[model samples]
Target: MKTYRYLDLITALFVVVLIVSNVASTKVVLLGPFTFDGGTILFPLAYIFGDVLTEVYGYKRSRRVIWTGFFLLMLAALTFGLVNLLPTPADPQSQGTAQAFSTILGLVPRIVLGSLVAYWVGEFVNSFILAKLKIATQGRWLWVRTIGSTLVGQGLDTGIFLLIAFYGVWDNSLLWTVFVSNYVFKVGVEVLFTPVTYAVVGFLKRREGEDYYDRDTDFNPFALGR
Candidate 1:
């Protein structure tokens, strides 16, 4: 393994925030009569960072970050489960708080699984496509690669997450609507942030003295030993 850099730590922290915010965002509420999960606001940032990691550091480093996120998510879910399983105080107020905590934390397993699977799938796809496009285009047309990869990657992430998390629970039509709408919203966020993404990628590459091309990378998601 290579020596750790300070920015890598920052990247890891952002990944954790992304996972936590994603799990917490499942609660739907009305925003001007349009119902949406709070997760929508934070989830796109994960993809943006995903793009940054892959673009600046390469697939191997990005894979490490992804796996770091995976373990952190698992630890969080396990901690939540353990906390929820412990006995609560007898006071009615305490009991209510415990119940609320349990209700939120109890969804950890499913949500964690959905997030892990979607993230692994979507991120790898995004990185792989972008890496290949970078080589094919000789690193020209950054916007096309970023937007194109997000279109496919976010689509897969949205579809997989919705199907796994709410398959039989939601009617097919409603499920499809949710999936499509979330996909559009996520991709829209990516599109809107393209300029920021460009700036960040450029700054990171210059500061880190690395604009990696994964020409020799092993694209396997499970090959974390790289």
Candidate 2:
């Protein structure tokens, strides 16, 4: 397998973002009128990372990183659940600590399902759209591909995740509100950070000498080709 100096770094960062975002999602936050989970603050960075990967390294590499994140996230979830289930010794401090641990690390089945499924679909969609756009535009406009892909990808992600995680649990109106707010906030993050994304993508392209255009590449998400 070929190695790039920064691919490993980016992949590691990508997984950290994914795992941390999911963990932070347990806490809901309200800033004035907008209601969102803590994940919203950092989840958008994952999409930016997606854009950077697909833009600089192409979809094949990006797909690999996405799968890496998915599996690591599942492992983290399983580990958290396992730890949450382990019997803790009966003591004043221990009991309090165990309860706090479960409160923070516990993973509900529906939420787990929503998170994994939505992430797999959303990230592939983002990478696939960006790859196709790169070819369609002859690589002229970076912003179009990044923002356009995020528009589609984040829209699907926000809607699918919220609906699956809270459809019946939350009021219909409230679910919709959360979905709309999260979607806007995520896409807004992509837009607001476009300058940074451009800088990173440009730097990587120059430094690594790889501006991949997936004209001949396979688009299958499951294929483990290099």
Candidate 3:
């Protein structure tokens, strides 16, 4: 087995971004004319990290990282669900605090399932597209690969998550609004952060001596053994 210096750090950051975004998703907020879950603010960064991982480490490693984030995210939701099931103290203050905790951290089964499924599918899509684009472009244009993948990947992520989590719960108009808003915002962030993505990719490739191309890789999301 081969190892790199920053792989662990990048994996750690990727998982952190995923878990935090899931937590933030409990609150819906409006930013200017856009209305979305608070997680929308930070969730896009996970794709950027996904781009970096696929661009530098290849899709195989990126698959491992994605699965790592997925499992950890599932564990977090389970943990919160467990805590929410525990009995609260009978004292008034304790009851209030407990209520707040449940309100904030209690994981809804539908939302949790939606989030996990969306992330798993969307990230794999993002990584697969970026990896293929990298090969197609011969690594010439980083911006195209990053933005292009985000366009499709984020679309799927937003649509899948929204439909699964809130299709019946939220007003149809509001759901459409958030869907459009999230897709645009996420893709916009990818475009705006192109320079940063290039810098990070360049640095990681240089430092780690790897600029992997998935030319002959399995491209399997569950093929973690290799």
* TM-score against native, each model: 0.91, 0.98, 0.98
Candidate 2 error regions (>4 Å): none
On residues 51-71, what C-alpha lDDT tens digit does candidate 2 reach at each position? 999999999999989999999
Which regions of candidate 3 fall more than 4 Å away from where they truly are? none
Please tell me which model should have the higher lDDT, number 1 or number 2.
Answer: 2
The C-alpha local distance difference test score for the whole of candidate 2 amounts to 0.91
Task: Write down the TM-score for model 1.
Answer: 0.91
lDDT score, residue 140, model 1?
Answer: 81
The number of clashing residue pairs in each candidate reads 0, 0, 0
Report the number of the highest-TM-score candidate: 3
Model 1 per-residue lDDT tens digits across residues 1-226:
4443556665766676676667666686544433456787678888888788877778888887877777787777788878888898899999999998877766646666777788778888988888888888887888888899899999998888777777888799888777767787889889999999999888877777888888888988889886
**Candidate 1, backbone clash total:** 0
Which pairs of residues collide in candidate 1? none
The lDDT leader among the candidates is 3
In the range 1-226, model 3's lDDT, one tens digit per residue, is 6789999999999999999999999999999988889999999999999999999999999999999999999999999999899998899999999899999999789999999999998999999999999999999999999999998899999999999999999999999999998888888889889999999999999999999989999987878997
Q: What's the lDDT for all of these models?
A: 0.79, 0.91, 0.93
